[model samples]
Target: MTEKDFIPKRYSESMEHGSVSWEAPSNIALVKYWGKKEHQIPANPSVSFTLKNCRTITRLDFSKKENQSDFDFEIYFEGNKKEDFKPKIKTFFERIVQYVPFLKEYKFEIHSENTFPHSSGIASSASGMSALALCVMSLEKKLNPEMREGFFRKKASFLARLGSGSACRSIEGDLVVWGKHQETRGSSDLFGIKYPDEVHENFKNYQDTILLVDKGTKEVSSSVGHNLMHNHPFAEARFAQAHENLAKLKPVFAEGDLEKFIEIVENEALTLHSMMMSSRPYFILMKPNTLEIINKIWSFRKRTELPVCFTLDAGANVHVLYPEKDKVKVLEFIKNELVAYCENGHYICDSVGDGALKLK
Candidate 1:
């Protein structure tokens, strides 16, 4: 056999792919996925873009280990034991097994890592699960050649949800919005989305700028905060606001309207933060530095009459979106003022980039 033929192959009742590797990025939701319906699916249909610059690299290899009672999953980020992440990995495995029982027949050795800092509220779940999804989907595509274009991606996203609530959005491309068919709206399979501009054209160069405000996301897990929202008295009206924002932003997104985009995105992010404030225990991600930066950006824009606007994710990180031309001045502002408070505070400037890709 030639060198190519020397590659070992397994043909068994269970999926037998030699190895699968991929990298996908974490997404910061603009219009958030707040509530869940069946299967913990989101109540409003949401959408987002898969970012390119910051992503998790994952590799899955299987060699038919002996103690395959059902499934075994191992995960790591930044080369350290991710003990807290095991349950979700197992849960995701169980979900996959529910659909394809044979995959459980073989033991899986899985390794995952994020390019960005861990536990820093970077939405690692989004990209981490996404990379895993692609890893699994690659094996699926190899084992089951008949799989269709979007078949594996969506299914893997649904499976990724079992790993983390925000993770489901990571499996697709840029412009990933998380929302699903509202039961009230008479739809099932209602969760994260990369909705194909149903009524208008999709923006080609959608972009964002991320400033790592702090590395202290351990303060509140999105999961805990999410549960708080569910029981809050204003949850219903708050969710309704998310829905309304979705409607307002979707059309502009399709049209690639930047002004409307800034308006709606800022409002949606603020709306999410507002909920965090009113939640019984009352959580807040914005610090003095956070607002100072925000005020400065708005002040600069208002003074110079520039158009850039800022938005915040669940954590203290801030995302500023503007035309690519503004990158120089924007970067200078961050380098000078934004990092003054915290020694570790840094920023990565990224624009809307392409979706996930295979490594092996």
Candidate 2:
């Protein structure tokens, strides 16, 4: 759908004060989205598995405001006031205010927390921004009771994209696709959509065990990394490669070709780092332990002939992806061989999930 389709008409109803809460899951991109354009449009089409256990829950309480000249909101993370986080939220509000115009009319209290540790290489922005966007959409739904369920979700994802690019994928399903691609029907750069094509049963309940190689914050943020791609020598080739890999994945996902899936996924992960490392002012986010864990996973997969593979976000941590049927053997290998590389031996076991949930 076009951007104009998401703009809402004048509301039929209004509330003086109310509260809304939602829990949104984190996602691991199989075909990663590394760069973007203005309005948070992605540089390439990407697909991801929505994660079950790593998530964020946000509750928004709003009251009618007497002074409505500016956006009014206070944000708390894990029950503690986080003044530093306000600017990001304010920027998000400003970006989406045109779409959800009631922002200035209400003073908001946003309480948010994550299931995974903050700064643990998890995409807290994906889950956190998505949860907050869902909460805001809930308020809009209340304001316009005539809004349809489908429209609500689409608009929520659109708003979430403004907060964080990857967040749009956290709004829906076991599999989600963001950005426009000829091969992926219904995909849009404006928002993420539940992958509409047939997915083989072999992928059902796929597992993702995250190994925390480093819990500290990164030296460079994802925004900076994406910006570097603007002048990157390989930027054009990488973007084209992502589309090619996504095309290759369609039949693989349909046929349940584990080997091809592994090839595409692992390549995408490494290529993401390659782009970062090759940039003019290059930097590395992967720690030494990250390589150690990857080698171990490769050895284990070679020895066991299992479908286990690894993917990385823009940080030192590694996400070990494998089919659900191999969970027992994979977890055993992870605990015994890979966990040693994790900081404090910390890891989280999670599986594919069906998107965000609204809480009463």
Candidate 3:
């Protein structure tokens, strides 16, 4: 749907005070979207696996105020007031106010927390922003009780994208696609949509074991990385490759071709890091242990003939993906061989999930 389609009609109803809460999961992109256009539009199409265990839970409480001149809000994280986070939330409210329209009408208290460590290569913004977006949409739904389920989800994702581009995908589950691609029906740059075609059973409940190679703040944030793509020497070709990779995955997904899936996913991960290294002011996000873990994963897969493979975000951590049937063997291998590469021997075991949950 177009951006205009997301703007709601003028509302006649009003609410004095209320509260809403939601939990939204993080996702791992198989076909990475490394660059973006203005308004959080992705430069190329990408698909991801929505994760179950790593997520953010957010609660929003709203009360009517006498003055409706400016947006009013207080933010808290894990039961503590977070002044540093206000700017991002303020910016988000500003971006979404045009569509939600009720931001200026009430004072809001937003309490949020993440199940996993923040800024630890886990795409916390995707889950955090999506959870907050779902809470805001709940308030909107209260104002217009007639809003359909489909529209609610669509607009929630639409608003989430304004907060973080990949956040659009966190609103749905299992497999979600963001950015417009010719091969993906009903895909849009405005938000993410579930893969419309049949997905092979092989992909269901797919496992993603994230190895925490480093938990510190990234040397280069995702925003800076995305901006680097504007004049990047290989930006055009990289964008084209994402589209081509996404297209290639369709048949592989449908046919349960794990070998082809591994090829595309691993290549996409390396390609992402390659772009970072090739930028004008080049930087590498991967740590030494990150490479070690990857090499170990490759060796183990080769020796065991398992469907295990690794993907990297824009950080030092590694996301090890494998089918559910191989979970027993994969987890054992990870603990015995790969855990040494992680920070403090920390890692998260997660699998595919079915979208966000409304807590209240």
lDDT of 1: 0.68
Pick out the ten consecutive residues of candidate 1 with the lowest summed lDDT.
1-10
TM-scores for all predictions: 0.86, 0.99, 0.99
Residue-pair clashes, model 2: 0
What would the per-residue lDDT of candidate 1 be over residues 100-180, giving only the tens digit for each residue?
554665666678877766655566777887788778777766766767666566666666776676777776666666654
The local lDDT score (0 to 100) that residue 119 gets in candidate 1 is 53
Q: What's every prediction's RMSD, in angstroms?
A: 6.5, 0.8, 0.9
lDDT of 3 by residue, 52-158 (tens): 99999999999999999998899999999999999999999999988998899999999999998775657699999999999999999888998999999999999
- Give the alpha-carbon lDDT of every model: 0.68, 0.93, 0.94
* Per-residue error (Å), model 3, residue 299: 0.7
Residue 83 lDDT (model 3):
92
Instruction: List where candidate 3 sits over 4 angstroms from the true fold.
Output: 119-121
lDDT of 2 at 322: 94
Q: Deviation in angstroms for 21 in model 3?
A: 0.6
Tell how far residue 70 is off in model 3, in angstroms: 1.2
